[model samples]
Target chain A: MILPYYIIIPLLAAFLISLIAGKKDNWAVILSVIATTALLVLSLFSFISMKDETVTYSMSAWSLPYGIVLVQDALTSFILVMVSIISFTSLIFSIQYIRHLSMDWKYYSLFMLLVTGMNGVIITGDFFNLYVFMEIALFSAFALVAYGSRAEEFEAAFKYAVMGSVSSFLILAGIAVTYSATSTLTMAKVAEVLPTNDQKVIFWIGALFMAGFGLKAAAMPFHAWLPDAHSSAPAPISSMLSGVLIKALGIYVLIRIFYNVFNAPEIFTKIFLVLGTISIIIGVFLAIGQWDMKRLLAYHSISQIGYILLGMGIATPLGILGAVFHLFNHAIFKSLLFYNAGSVEMALGTRDLRKMGNLMKILPTTSQTSLIASLSISGIPPFNGFFSKLIIIIAALQAGLPWYAVFAIIGSLLTLASFMKVQRYGFKGETTVESVENKVGWRMNTAMIILAVLCIATSLMVVPGIQEVTLDPVVKVIADKTEYIQLVLGGMNGN
Target chain B: MQQNDGMTLIVKTVTRISVWMILLYGIYIIFHGHLSPGGGFAGGVIIALALLNVLLAFGRKFTSEWLNISFLHDLESASATLFLVIGILGISLGGAFLANFMNKGELFALLSAGTILTLNIFIGIKVGMSLFLVVWVLAGSKIVKGE
Candidate 1:
């Protein structure tokens, strides 16, 4: 019952805004904010209350095997919390940041649609339904990427669309193959039936999905579109894309499919390891070379995603724990980092690191919060990023993959180096502070501060008692894969 | 009204009679969707084509009075909203999202499939309006610039 509202609220907000909100965007803002806030509250409630439960809501009252079901386990709830929190803050940020581009209701409507798609993806248990929701998210993302309407923005959007289409088709193809092989659309039923089928079928599906979702996740091989699309969008949108979208549409789906549905096949997990390593090393090197502030941040998104992938690929209990924790932590600090980039971009009228001067005296909140975010991303202590990365490194070493751990450590060092460049040339360039084009608004600053606060606060998830209540359940969901079959099928009261 | 309103007289004359017939045929398909292959989507495309036919033969000037972008947009949005409302209504009345709240009626009958029929009507309206709106905005006006 509570499950559908996650989608219904944002979807209703989107249509209601489109239907009623006029050229002016005040109503749109009110509707979207209310919707997102409600979602945030609902997801948090579910995350706390349903920590140990596997609740499923069968759509249209059809039994499992025939109907699309919405499942909420620890993993779903955790990702739900991440999506809602980021979207809520991003909405606040957008109320101001998007105004710099245009004061149109269209942005809010599209924004709500994006939220709807991601929430729908997180909740649905049917593969076809997931693909539909993914398309909804992708379409809105393409439109939003081109929201600026500059030539370069359009070019980036075009590139993203082309890549997005190819990936979507691959996903659709994977779905078709799965449906044909297993004769079921429900994930649990498919999982039950897949083992009896030929082993090669699973490989083809895994390969197809990895190529498809891997492109969406922007892993090393399929990472061309991330920088342009993320950098080209407006600031708050940049945050949403980097901080939440890839993780939601990319990593979340990958985890659910690879871990839960496919039961973490060794071959695919091996692929994840290789992809993760390449993305980590190459992405940071690419980041250090970029002069564009947003572009550099975009490259870092690829690298940080690599960290999450590395954690997930390790597949041990601690590795999965680290992956899940890092997913949330990266979402917080990365969003904060993008907000900093956006605020700075607005004030300085540039995203070039060399073009920026010291912003310490001006835009104090952005610089300070950015310092926290940078330190967090660099795996400095007292912030959540360090703890999650340490867990992954330890897990790798524990699993007898010392070389992988070394690579991860090297990746962490490259990340620190890259962000140091962001700090140095971006905020402390020799160029003196001069007249600024824009002033950071309170709404945007408030949004940034919320995530910045979370950057430090979410580290509490790792505390012993808190970890049992929160992170433990989520990791158990991924680690003990067989439990998913029972949970989705009639073993638990999903209602 | 003018000599240069649209295409040849035969096309205009044919369009005046054919558009309504096309719309009538589309309505038939939508209402019979639960029993037939052509449901909301196919019928809706036909309906949009009917209106597009009007614009083709009579030009934008003739359609400007009752047919416009915003009107179609509102219609599309209103129908989609209704469609969602029907689905949500299922939760309140039938215990699940998009459940068949109303009596499903007898199979192979015109009124069967309960909410699906009503849902189809709204989908048809939305799809038709949306398709027409797309064409209207993209190439609805005069081809020559400065219209």
Candidate 2:
């Protein structure tokens, strides 16, 4: 029942916002806030109440094979909570940011649909259902990226659309092959059936899915569209895109399929290791060269995601733990950084580091949050990112991959250097920025502050006692491969 | 033949009758969708095509005068909302989300599948309105014209 509502509430909010919210957009803002708030509360409740249990809801009273299932397991709940929290703050941020662009209700509607799509992806147990929800999320994403309607915005949206379509086609073909091979669309059933069949189809499915979701995740090889699309989007949207969208659509699916479904085959693990290392090295190098503030953060999103993938690729208990924990931490701090970039852009009308200077006083909240997020991204001790990256690096070394560990260490140092450049040039440059064309509103600052606090608070997730409850359960889900099949198939108590 | 006048008079005359027939046929297809191959989506496209036919034959001016854009927008939103609500309503009434809670009517009857028929109607309305609105906006946009 609760699983269905995660998608239903936001979908209803999207349609109802369009239905009721007029030209003023007051109603649109109110409804989006309410909807996201409700989702955040609901997802938090689900995460707490069902700490380790798997709950599945079969649509229309149909059983496993015929019906599409919505599952709320530890992994699903963790991702859902990440999405809800980020979306709630993003909406609060959007209230002011989007108003400055235009007092349009369409933005709110599209945002709700975006949430609905992510929630659906997280909740659905059927492969085809996940595809449908992803399409919903992407359609809105394409529109939102083009909302600014600048020539570059159009250019970015066009590039993103082409990349998205090609990935989607590959995914669809993969699904077709999977279905033909397994004779089922339900993921658990597919898991049960896939192993009994030929291993070659499994390799094809893994490769296609790796490339497809890899593109969506913006892995190094398939990362061409990400910087443009993520940076070209409106600010709150940029935060959402970098923070949760790629995680939900790309990394979460990657983990679920490769680990839970396919059970972490050696070849894909090697593929993941090479790709993750390359992304870690190359993404930071690409990030180091960016002058555009949002573009810098966007490229860093690629770099940060590299850490998570490396953690997953390592495929140890500690490594999966690091990946999951870093997934949460990156969502918090990356979103905060985007908020800083957005606020700076809002205040000064430029995203170029050269154009920005001495904003520490003028935009105190944004600057301080930027500092926390910067230190967090750079793996400074006591912040969440440090612990996760340390775990990932340590896990890499422990797993007998010292060279990859050294590369990660190098990536971390480069990241620190890159962010140091940001702090020096973008926020604390010698020149004083005098006039603010538009002041950063309280709501935007409040959103930034919320994430900044979470940057520190969520690091507690790795604390031994708390880790046992929160991060440990999720890691257990990913670590025990065939357990997902039993947990999902064994728990089909639909409402 | 003339700018914004649409097609020739002969074509207009032929479209005048054909458009209404298309509209009627689309409704028939949508209503019969639960039992037939052509469902809500196909029928809705047909319904939009009927309006598009008028646009091509009679012109933008005539179509704009005859229909309200905002109303079409509202219709689209309302039907989509109704479609979703109908699904949730099935759950509230008892079984599961999107359960066919209502009594299944006689086999081959016009009112057969309980929730599917209602869902089809709503989806039909939504798709038809949205498609027409999309055509309307694209035709009207300066950016689309590259001007």
Candidate 3:
């Protein structure tokens, strides 16, 4: 059924790019462009067919409970689309972003491998398979983090690796325990067999997932690795990591397992709420103090992720729909911001806000894109972020969690304040004579322009009738976990 | 680079065989998952560790030529493909997605596990090769550095 193309094409590209990418760097660019573009098309196709169908592909003509499996539904297809779009834009951005870097082929290879992992994570249905993909993404991220190999970059990568390893180990252990309990690793089987009365082991598994995936998502307290890692990575990579990778590997899986497989208790709702609230309050406060451009965005990522979890934590249909909408919105604008940061770095060679002043006239496109992204992320009217945040806040109030609504609003305002600081210091001030002399690359400009356009375009997903078709099925997946499992497994048996 | 004079402990060689042992044991666990305990992930880890052991023993030069971080990479991706095919077949067969053990050939036999065994093998190869490559790249990073 060609379920594995997402994983295969990237792997093939990485292999070919590495083999043929000596000195003639354009080959690497062409390869990644083709691969990402194809992925984007495939994802769009999946989205079109996914609403009313569940696709199950078995291995070697085997059935589930005995063979490997891949399931595609509205949720998976939607995420796949998001993953591919960001990857495509990022690859475009890399053409100019990595122009000065050494070992251009290796960088491109790692980047493609990273995309493969993200794609695999979003599309895979098996629990163990998810772990394997997580490792692929994490390992690639580790290498990318240290690509610069500056003392600080190496230091940050090492920190990220250590913490990531711990998180991975926790997930490994959780999967092991879950297997021991359920005697099956497939999500369908677990949902079918999961007991209503939670045991100690179930609690342990929950804790393990919370710690492991939370670390990946950069949730509060577990988020120590985020700022350093995001700030140090090249801008496009930073965008990818913050924009899509975290949502895919961390929050998406967390929600899937919690809602479907584990059939988690009401306690999870409260736990997610507390976690989300804390992250919202703390992440923005921390971001407000950041001097580095990417670092500021990294912290806001934490705060933004808070709203997603908070919305999902409510566990209402509106809450889940809001969460999904916010997830999509965040992916677009956050990546746009990262692209803007990359453009700034490409021109100035520094992400330090203090070193960047009043260059709006010098880099008008970048300045305008940065403004749109900042305003969108801060929940300004007419952009996608505003509607998503509004849905989450309204959902919170409807769920009788009025305090969470307040926190969400405050977080949004703080996000606005922080980005305002960035706009004032980084883009609004006078361009120095030295800064004005610096030339920006065409590829970087083109990439940012495309992403900026997307930031504006994705707002259509929130349009009343439009969202019913594109976003509703995805929210239905979350709202009807029982139906999801039944549909996937039922389809697997062709019933 | 520091060189030990004599009796130096080589983590690579020892880790190789251990990785192999883990791989074989992982297979045992995965295939036996339905009747007893353990499933694809634990079993897959064992298998991956085994392959990783061989890579450690050979060093990046030999492992690079043999496992070839690039080649192992393809194996990892292909296994995921195999996994997807299995799930879709279930759909085509009129079962739900990922509906395993539907045929119910024999309960405890190796072949009886049906899709469970296939999932195990696929995960074993994917995890084994991917982890091995991760360790290999990390240890032999000096070789990977280029301009």
Displacement of the residue B56 alpha carbon in candidate 2, Å: 1.4
**TM per candidate:** 0.97, 0.98, 0.81
lDDT of 3 by residue, B1-147 (tens): 222311234765466447656766877887777767777767767776666655545544555555556656667667766766676565567354445645667767767656767777777676666666667667766654543
Winner on lDDT between 1 and 2 is 2
Off by over 4 Å in 3: A196-199, A434-438, B1-147
User: What does the i-RMS of model 3 come to?
Assistant: 7.9
The 0-to-1 C-alpha lDDT of every candidate, in the order given, reads: 0.90, 0.92, 0.81
- Candidate 2 docking DockQ: 0.83
Task: Identify the superior model by TM-score, candidate 1 or candidate 3.
Answer: 1
User: What DockQ does each listed candidate score?
Assistant: 0.80, 0.83, 0.08
What i-RMS does each candidate reach, in Å? 0.6, 1.0, 7.9
Name the regions of candidate 2 deviating beyond 4 angstroms: A493-495, B1-4, B144-147
Q: Which ranking of candidates, highest lDDT first?
A: 2, 1, 3
Mark the 10 consecutive residues where model 2 chain A has the least summed lDDT: A486-495
Q: Per-residue alpha-carbon lDDT of model 1 for A1-495, expressed as tens digits?
A: 699998999998998898999665799999999999999999999999987888888888887767788888999999999999999999999888888878899999999999999999999899999999999999999999999977889889999999999999999999999999999988888888888988999999999999999999999999999999999988778888888889888999899888888989999888888899889999989988888988988999999899899999999999999989999999899889888988898898888889888788788899999999999999999999999999999999999889889988998998898889888887877888877788898998999889889989999989999999999999999898856888889742444
The candidate scoring highest on TM-score is 2
After the best TM-score superposition of candidate 3, give how far the Cα of residue A435 lies from its true spot, in angstroms. Answer: 4.2
Which of 1 and 2 is the better model by TM-score? 2
lDDT of model 1, residue A267: 91
